[model samples]
Target chain A: MSSSSPLLAELIDALRCLPGVGAKSAQRMAFHLLERERERGLKLAGVLEQAMQRIGNCSRCRNFSEEPVCALCASSSRDRHVLCVVESPTDLAAVEQATGYRGQYFVLLGRLSPLDGLGPRELGLHLLTERLAEGEVEELILATSPTVEGEATSHYLVQLARAGGVKATRLAHGVPLGGELEYVDRGTLAHAFGSRQSVE
Target chain B: MSSSSPLLAELIDALRCLPGVGAKSAQRMAFHLLERERERGLKLAGVLEQAMQRIGNCSRCRNFSEEPVCALCASSSRDRHVLCVVESPTDLAAVEQATGYRGQYFVLLGRLSPLDGLGPRELGLHLLTERLAEGEVEELILATSPTVEGEATSHYLVQLARAGGVKATRLAHGVPLGGELEYVDRGTLAHAFGSRQSVE
Candidate 1:
């Protein structure tokens, strides 16, 4: 039956905004949460509230963390001298899942879209310049996707790194056109990282 | 990345149990709830918890309701003498969405499944006899789907209603073979209701 409570309907509508969820699926999820074990559902709500309240971007690499620095940046085993630039924390996660990367990551948080008014300055290019000026980062790996916007982001980063006197390179080609990094297999990611080429 | 936080992961797992939700969709929803507005997410949780805690089977019809008697059952406009019987609350809602019937409903809560050890006794068939004995219901409509199990449930209910001395009928022949009532459009449902045939 149609929900008598408008609050319940609003909540379900909010949930429907999540990727790939439609009205019927959202209704089922809402009903399951409301009509089954509610404590478990509330616990999830608590987690969401806590994460939104506490999670922040790492000052150094921009991966989400509870502290000033992310776990990867804080780890001494990772090579700080070879920084890998990526588009988002989600992409950084896919790379980490591959388990072959032992380098630091610099997440852009978004790709350049000039038509959408997104440019280097808006994407924290100045902060990246400051990080490069710290003189520890020597080799910079561009691991953004092969998409038009991703390519533009990588090229801009390469110019920024070169101007700052750091060696800049893009990950080796093999990433299919229009393919997201999340869809690439771990082995392909490892191969791409191993065969990275200089971006002249 | 797969959610590292146990609480968030549990919630996501629970959400994924809803029909049509996959792992990727669950992950995306989990992230949205965690990263976006916490209040909205928590409100959804609260709705779920409240619904499960407060809503339960309607005393008169056995359909899920926030009150002792469901809105449909208590409504002055609805035909109290006619009751549409269904297998579950989801099925009840499906019929209501069709908007062809202005009568109330009686949800069986489950169908008879002898193979799964679910018989009429297990599905509260005894309680149905009590309602039929009240003698207010003039016509009983079998709105249950045409599935093997659904047919079995309908057959059993028809026998019970006949012995109770009530006029009983099954929703008409227009419904597609092996098709569920939830998938049928309102027009067909209206037509089916208008052409309902008496059941032996």
Candidate 2:
């Protein structure tokens, strides 16, 4: 028996564009969409298109939103004086979900990747500069990833903040919660040891 | 930052219906669709709807197809005297992909599970019986799974074929090809030892 029809094969190929979906998973997803839940499949399509249309870059923070200014940036309860810069909306969401941050966020949308043609301009660094020049922010916390690109972006932002007369800080790096000492890398272990906090 | 917009959240939820897709994977898929592959995402939806509408059960073999009689049953080169019964279209495709089997197939669509109310009628056993009575099938090959339900279904099928005056056969089972002896289970080891064949 042939594994697929033309339409189904096309659908499977398209499904491969999704992150982490390989050929086998794409096939399974295509079969699932065709055989069991056509309604849900169609709904996903509608939602994708709707989201693309409704969710544009937030003018202030570069996060996705339905309007020019997102609800988070428009909220009055958040301290405008404290700004947390994250690499992506997903990272910002994670920090928010952890529930300690009451500051506003500026999403980089991407990190500086010179090889990939993603520079400071590509990451909306000019817009960030404008925000910094506004002088409303007193503290800038860098929450980018610990990767090389993330570190470079964070360093660049820290310098930019200092030049704008704002205090700059970074999220701490160390062994993760419940992580074993044996599994910690040499660089991370050294950093953690150097930055040890006093119990008092 | 909020993790999702309403439309994006809906897409993520809908994507969870696929096999192996959990909350995190669904979220990633939703982001991939909205941010990178909007066209492909929309194309998947269209193709899914089209395939669902076009593909139906083949009248003869009960496999999914765009027509009543599938391409396989409509083919003139296939042997009509031999039939391979399988549990699903995916299984049928797998056997075809493995090669060497050129006979026609009868798809059960499902197996017998009384607890779930999937009885003989649900598995189209009566239709299988009718096909056996037509007398064109000289050999009925059972290719259902080797689970408990699969064993019961195979036994019922073998008995039904015998009563219909047709020769019934099962695929050989034992240690898999190139399998490690130490990993082989006791029952399979016993069966392999008992059924050892001559090298000559």
Candidate 3:
């Protein structure tokens, strides 16, 4: 849209940097900030600037952090023996929120996607290898997504765990708890059926 | 969600000031920025701060502007004899983009809603009255939405136009273009039927 004000145009254009925000949504956000939420918008700008400049990855787990090490990785209360590996901070957050796994975490920051130039080095596998070789961790839980890349990343991590004499396990792939069998997609249903476990 | 970093938490909280952004979307936006778009995020912060601090209402038309007057109001190419009044700058942009209108514009910035504390004064109708009284405008177009408050605002503007001895016109309201009669809402169909006109 042709905005009469150059600053308004710039604001709208800048808002598009956010995920899922397009031209119309950006315009709406700019107008909203201008019309009603100028104070909060200013606060957002301040916070955004601070986050972009100060927030860094945890030196140990590679999760986002303002300190040298993230709080989760630095906490002494968390278990050090069982390490859950996730692809990104978002997935780590999902696991933290949905499950009761209170062990330590290792954030890969990305899956092993060679086409996207993401490899073991980019994912900070060396740090994970060092952690595993420290002889503290007894188990490595592969909690990456079930996508092809996620599986490959998990498989690679399993080898590293084996080399370090740590037990490696994968998150179960099956139909969701509430999902009906008939409505489940063929791939998930087939995988669930093939991996059917004996009733405990 | 429990963010490991306080700055990350603050960033997510601040992002919710945007229109339509909730907790989940804010978290996603924060992570997306942290993970891949830190440079753009910082750029957005700079632009957002500049926009919030520098942008002000146009002295003549009440549209957003960084200077004393907006580009549209300052343009000599636009006709000064006809003025289109809109509820907001977004509406003004919509009219400017969707139509061939070349006249000047007056942005109310809001409609007449007493419960929401939006009155004629808040809408900048005083400036508009002064503009109409200047005798430069021959026609005052009421382009407000057809909601209860918008209708009331338009009715009040009509009186202002009459008092200023200027002709007043309203946007044609009926079934939307390409809308089938069967699918059109009852109120719109009834209004369209009542205001049926001959093809010119």
Candidate 4:
């Protein structure tokens, strides 16, 4: 740190806040910004500040939005009776991009990790229950992830949906398309085999 | 992109300005900054702006420094007569960290890449020659990288130094310490064998 200027040291320390960026990577990033792309660096600072100040969570869906209601939740074209639950906003975006589903979405914000002090409350299950209690939602689709925490969160929510007299469903687990059976994990292969459907 | 909020999209685009960061990594970084470390993100923006505005080339060695002359060049104890020419400030820092060399440094800022239109002027070789003409410098150490461009630059500088009646030296090329003979590249092994030093 003594080898670099105070400005450089501060930039490097700030860059380290980025996920997966270590000390060496931070230094390289700082140098790239300072020496190679100063204008872009300045623009990045402006955009970061503006975005941070303007962005917030959608009050209902828990996805990112500048306003209280996100675009997806506010849209009339989306099916209000069907709701998709996901572990994060990124997952919600991926689903929207890759699928033809036109249902409303509720982002869990994170999966339930009781060990990390995350539970039903952290996943915003109370808000979800409130939404379900309104009696408008008929189907709850769980799309959290394929991980243990995602499964546990889905299980908890499925019970909540059933209690509210709503149908609860989850994404089907199977071998990925174009995947070789030999290369697939044993658990996934077994699950796919056990859940086999008749070919039409 | 259409599904994400405007605030989120702007942040992701800004994050893409970072070196080695792509669209997916940019999205992940944006989400992490917005959802997990907003305060640090704000601080990072501030630090980036401040560093971009303040840091510039050191007047003497052309390395990064906030002051007119860098600490290494300005220090009273360092030998002004022995100057080490390196490709970048990072190289200068590495030499200082790994070696006991007590010499001043001259950063080339780049190397002689003729195809990319880089030549003596681009590498600040004219300024270096002017410094040599002052006659205070007794030796010029060529510490460019081991690439083709670096070798060509070093050879050119050696001729410049010799014309000015100043001694020129280069970092020794050899098999790296702790390197396995079986794994060593052919070029390095040949260089080490050709420059073999006699035992006392």
Candidate 5:
């Protein structure tokens, strides 16, 4: 708070709004920006602003994208007939980093939690059902987190996918208990991808 | 890294340039920024750019400022005859936070490291000597780090201030060895200020 520059203090406060950054960490980061070249700091600021402005949910897959369709959705190399569903953009990134899945992704903005007022409609389950009914999606992979909410979400999606006549499964084998794919090691992720068993 | 969005990867790389921010931490920060409103991200970016463009060294005391003299140097409440010298603006903030010293500051920009080619002139020791000769400053407080380079710089400054007929002292009595003022608690920092002993 005793920092001489008001702008620097404001910038630090804005950065501290981040999930893990505290006041001290934000101060350190502000000092780092001060120490570096003006161009470097400006570039970082520009990237932050630009990303927030341009990126949104892909119209088809609901994954984050700068355009109407995400790169994965647009890529012909990807298997359109197989869709891997995830809870958030972060989870989608983790799966992509594993580099084992050749299929496209469908990002559910949230999981089904009726207690918290998050119902199937809030998770866009109707849209998913419509997508499944198109008959192009042969297999549906449930790649949500291993939390209680995630389990319920996967079960609901699987039932819906099966009723729509598409094969549906959950990721198993290498994924540990209470695991978040984002924090898992790459080898473990690859192994999990390779050894995934049928949920039914 | 073959990420879905190259811009996201770029932002993460930029975030990693911050002190103590590793790749994973940077990714987390980048994602957090991306999740926020575009206006929030732009506000941070704008502050960063504006701070860099507007803030510069105070002409009198060398601390960060938008005007000719920094707030401390320009204020009538501050002891114009006492100057607290530090390695950077952040260090100056730490001293100010202790609230034991109402004095102006001279930022060295960096410490002396002969191996790194940072000699006396590089740290603006000549300007410090000139300031002392101008005659209002009665005390020169060496508030630099406890590192070898800081000690070497302090020794050099002490000799210069003595020749200029001003009292030169290092805040050694309360400062711990191998510790940075930025990380020191405010209580210890105030104790260090209160118990400062003179250096030869």
Candidate 6:
């Protein structure tokens, strides 16, 4: 759309850099900032600049952090013997919130997708190998998603763990808790049926 | 969500200032920027800051502009005898792009919503009245929306045009072009039935 103000056009264009924002949404955001939220918009700009410049990956876990090592990795209270591996920082956060896993974490940042140029090196598997070779970790928990790429990454990590003499485990895939079996998708239902445990 | 990086947390919080962005969307946007679009994210910050600081209302038309007078208001090619009053700059752009109307414009920035503190003064009707009283404009077109607030604002503008001895006209309202009448809303269908136009 043709904008009367060049700056307004520029603002709308810049807003499209955000995920899920398209032309119409970008225009709405730009107009919203101009009409109602100028102060907060300025604050956002300041914070965005700082985040882009200062936020870096954790040297140990590969999670986003301002420091060399993330808070979760640096914390002495968390267990160091069981390491949970996740696809991204968001997945790491999901695990932290949903489960009572008190083990340390290793963020892959991405799955092992050769088509997208992501492999063991891109996932910082060397750092994970060094950590496992330290002999402090007794088990490596693979918490990647159930998608094909996630499964492939988990399989690769399991091999790495086996090479380091650490026990490898994975998150269970099945019909979710509180969900009706009839309402579950076919793949999930089939998986749950195949993995059913015998009652004692 | 607990973020390892304080800057990342702040960026997520700041991103919520954008229209339609909630916690989850903000987190996704922040991570997307940190993971892939760092350069574009920084550029967006710079442009956002410049837009927030530099953009202001046009002196004549009340549209957003970096200059004291917007390009549309300053142009000599547009017909000075005709003035189209719109609710916002976006509407002005819509009219500019969709039609061959080469008249001048007056942007109200908002409609008449007293509870929301948008009065005639806030809508810049006084400036419009002054422009009308200058005797340069022979016709004033009211292109506000068909909503109650928009109608009220248009009614007020009609009176202002009458007082200035200028002809007043409003946009035709009915079922939209290419829209099925069966699917049209009751109120709009009723209005269209009541105001059926004669064949030329």
The candidate scoring highest on lDDT is 3
Candidate number with greatest DockQ: 3
**How accurate locally is residue A114 in candidate 5, as Cα lDDT from 0 to 100?**
91
**Could you give the CAPRI-style class of model 5?**
acceptable
Candidate 6 residue-wise lDDT, B1-200, digit = tens: 35467778889999999989999899899989988999999999999999999999999999999889887788888899999999987788778878999999999998999999999899888899889888999999999999999999999998899999999999998899999989999999999999999999
Q: Model 2 in CAPRI terms: which quality?
A: acceptable
Candidate 3 backbone collisions, by pair = none
Candidates in order: C-alpha RMSD to true structure:
6.9, 2.7, 1.6, 2.5, 6.6, 2.1
Write one digit per residue (lDDT tens) for candidate 4, span B1-200.
Answer: 45648778877888888999998899889888888998999999898888888889887788898888777778889898999999997787679878999988899988999899998998888788888998989999999999998999999999999999999999989999998998999999999999999999
DockQ of 5: 0.47
Native contact recovery (fnat) for each candidate is 0.28, 0.50, 0.93, 0.72, 0.56, 0.87
Better of 1 and 3 by TM-score: 3
Query: Which ranges in model 1 have alpha carbons more than 4 Å from their true place?
Result: A3-11, A31-42, A114-117, A174-200, B2-15, B32-42, B114-122, B173-200
Model 2 misplaced regions, further than 4 Å:
A1-4, A32-39, A52-54, A197-199, B1-4
lDDT of each: 0.75, 0.82, 0.92, 0.88, 0.79, 0.91
- Give the Å error, residue A173, model 1: 3.0
Ranking by lDDT: 3, 6, 4, 2, 5, 1
Off by over 4 Å in 5: A1-3, A173-200, B1-3, B36-39, B174-200
DockQ of each: 0.29, 0.47, 0.82, 0.64, 0.47, 0.74
For residue A126, give model 4's deviation from the true position in Å: 3.2
Tally clashes: model 3: 0
Give lDDT tens digits, candidate 2, residues B119-152. Answer: 9988888888999999999999999998889999
Clashes of each: 2, 0, 0, 0, 0, 0
At residue B97, candidate 5 shows an lDDT of 78
* Pairs with backbone N, CA or C atoms under 3 Å apart (clashes), candidate 4: none
User: How far does residue A39 in candidate 5 sit from its true spot (Å)?
Assistant: 2.7
What digit string (tens of lDDT, one per residue) describes model 5 on residues B95-197? Answer: 8876688777889989998888888887888888888988989999999887778878888889888899999888755667799889988877897899777
Consecutive 10-residue window with the lowest summed lDDT within model 6 chain B: B1-10
Candidate 4 i-RMS (Å)?
1.6
